[model samples]
Target: MRLLLIEDSAELAKWLAKALQGSGYAVDMAHDGQDADHLLFTQTYDAVILDLELPSMDGLTVLRRLRARGSTVPVMVLTARGELSDRVAGLNLGADDYLAKPFELSELEARLHALIRRAHGVSAPLITLGPLSYESVGRTFTLGGATLALRPKEHAVLEVLLLRGGKAISKEKLFEKVFSVDATTGQDVVEIYIHRLRKQLHNSGVSIITLRGLGYLLEAT
Candidate 1:
C-alpha cells in the first residue's frame, strides 16, 4: 500500500516513515499541511497518516479540505494530545482512526492495515484466490505449495489484483497503490513492472491476463 504522512516533527516523521516503509508500504512524507494538501489533492493514496499539530496549515484544515472535496481516502490522526475531546474532534472531522503519541509502531502498522483494508472493502486480513494465498505481513505470495518473495511494490500491486480475484484494475489505480510519489512518469512504466510480474507469474504457471484497454488481472487457469 502507498501512504502519505503529514507530520511536522522531523525526528518522529523520519522514524515513522522508516518504520512504515519496513512494513511494506510506500510512504511519502510532508512536513507541513500545504505540501500534504498538494499531495492529497493531486496524487492518489490508499491511506494518510495525518498529525494534528502541523507547521503551516494544521492537520485539521487539511483533513477538512480533503473531506470537503469529496475525497473518501481513509485518514488516521496521529497526535500528541490524548484527551477525549481531541479524539472526538478528529473523528468528527472524518478521521477513520486515531493514535496517540508514544504508541507502539506495531499498533500503528496494524491500524494502517485495518484502514487500508476497510477502505478497499476487505473485512479480512487474509486475501486468497484460487491456489494462491497472500501473506500481507510477510509480503509473500504462495502458489502450489511454494512461496515467492515479492518486492514491496510488486507485492502491493499483486495484492490489489488478487483481492479482486482476476478483475481488471486500472493502471492509474495500480500506480496509486504501488508508488507513493510520481505515479505518471509514463503509463509505460506501469506496463514495465506489470510485464515483469506477468512473466514471473506465468513461469510459475499462474496466469496473469492484461485486458488491453482496461488494465491487468490475475486469472490462473
Candidate 2:
C-alpha cells in the first residue's frame, strides 16, 4: 500500500520512510504541513501517518480540512503529544489511530496494518482465497501450505489484489497503490508485476483475471 507520511522532523521522517518501505509499503514523505496538505488534496493513499506538530499548518487543521472535504482516508496521528486532551482532540478531528513518540517501530507497523485492514473492512490478519493465503503481519503469501516466494514489486501487486479480491481494480489504481509518487517507472510496470503474479498463482485454484476495459480481479477457479 502507499502511505503519505506528514512529519516535520527530517531525521525521523527519513528513518520512518526507510523502515516503512522495507516492510512492503510505498511511502511518500512531506516534511511540513503545507506540502502534506497539498499532497493529500491531489493524491490518494491507503492511509496517512501524520504528526501534530507541523509548519505552516497544524496536523489537526489538515485533518479537519480533509474530513470537511469528505475524504474517508484513514489517518493515524504519530506525535510527541500524548496527553489525554490531545488524543481526544485528534480523535474528534477524525484521526483513526494515535501513537505517541518514543514508540517502537514494531508497534507502529502493527497499528498501521490494523488501520488499513479495518479501512478495507477486513477484520482478520489472515486474508485467504482458494489455495492462496496471505499473512498480513509478516507480509507473506502461501499456496497450498507452501511459501510463495515473490520479488518485492510482485508481492506488492499481489497484496493489492488479495486485499480487494473479487473486485475489479483498474491498472492505473493498482499502479498508484504499488508505486510511490516519486517513482520514475512507467504505469506499464504494473502489467509486468501482474504477469509475474499470474505465473506464480498458476494452477493454485486462484486466478487473476483481466476484464478487457474494466481492469483486473482475483478469483477462485
Give the least accurate 10-residue stretch of model 1, judged by summed lDDT: 179-188
lDDT of each: 0.81, 0.92
lDDT of 1 by residue, 123-165 (tens): 7666776667776544478876678667766777777787675
* Backbone clash count for every predicted candidate, in the order shown: 0, 0
What RMSD value applies to candidate 1?
2.3
lDDT of 1: 0.81
> Any runs in candidate 2 off by more than 4 Å, and if so which?
none
**Cα RMSD for predicted model 2:** 1.1
Quote each prediction's TM-score: 0.88, 0.96
